[model samples]
Target: MRIAFLLALLAGGVYYTYVAFIDLNFLTRTGRLGPGFFPRSVGVMIVLLTIWALVDALKEGREAATNAGLWRDVAMLMVLAIIYAVALRVFGGFVATVLYLAVTLSVLNRGRPLQNALLSILVPVAVYLLFDRVLNASMPPGLIDILPI
Candidate 1:
């Protein structure tokens, strides 16, 4: 499994490197550097690291990779992030942040619902105050503008 995973990673790195190479426009010159510079450099590095991983995995004895129990949590977190981004546009930063943090804390600390709820609300309010008052940075007045205060 480790070998297979490494091989897949290497294959993906190769494909990414190839795509980066093709996307690189050496003709369009920028003020400081060419457009292809960073992509080309990063792509090469990824390929090199992936190759090293593959070699290391191949050298190791074959063993079954244990399935980590946290994959579901990670997948849910990813979905939550997507939803949170959309929520920011619809509910505004404070409201959306409150919702996101509340849900995330609840998800993480299932046994301590009250604690999570308190922290969730408090954290967002603190962040809002810090940014809006101290920094004086303008936050997006998302749909409805529910949090005018």
Candidate 2:
């Protein structure tokens, strides 16, 4: 697990570095700090943190192997993220977010249906109101376009 985590982190660091440096147009006269500055900083931090974690895991002498079901959690989260992404495109941000939250909560909390439902519905609605109504941000128009707010 430690090895896998380290490798993943390293890969992400490299990818982000590329995005921040190679792909970013830093030559523009947009100021001292270009669009890539933050990404590059983040990439550097990721690399450093991964290295630290790797060292810490090695020092523990436990092989970083645990039956804590980390992979399952990671998979569930990934699935939820994908669902949210796709749903945002089709169902719009509000509906997609609610569905994603509900599904994620249901999957994670297998025995709690009522709590999951309430949370899924209420959380998204709250976020929608905060961003769309209060902050004047745009959200996806869901199937029920009547309430674009």
Best by TM-score: 1
Considering only N, C-alpha and C atoms within 3 Å, which residue pairs clash in candidate 1?
Answer: none
Give residue 139's lDDT in candidate 2 (0 to 100): 80
Q: What is the TM-score of candidate 1?
A: 0.62
Worst 10 residues of 2 by lDDT: 140-149
Cα error, residue 139 of model 1, in Å, equals 3.0
TM-score of each: 0.62, 0.55
Q: Each prediction's Cα lDDT score?
A: 0.82, 0.80
Which pairs of residues collide in candidate 2?
none
Winning model by lDDT = 1
Which residue ranges in model 2 land beyond 4 Å of their true spot? 1-62, 141-149
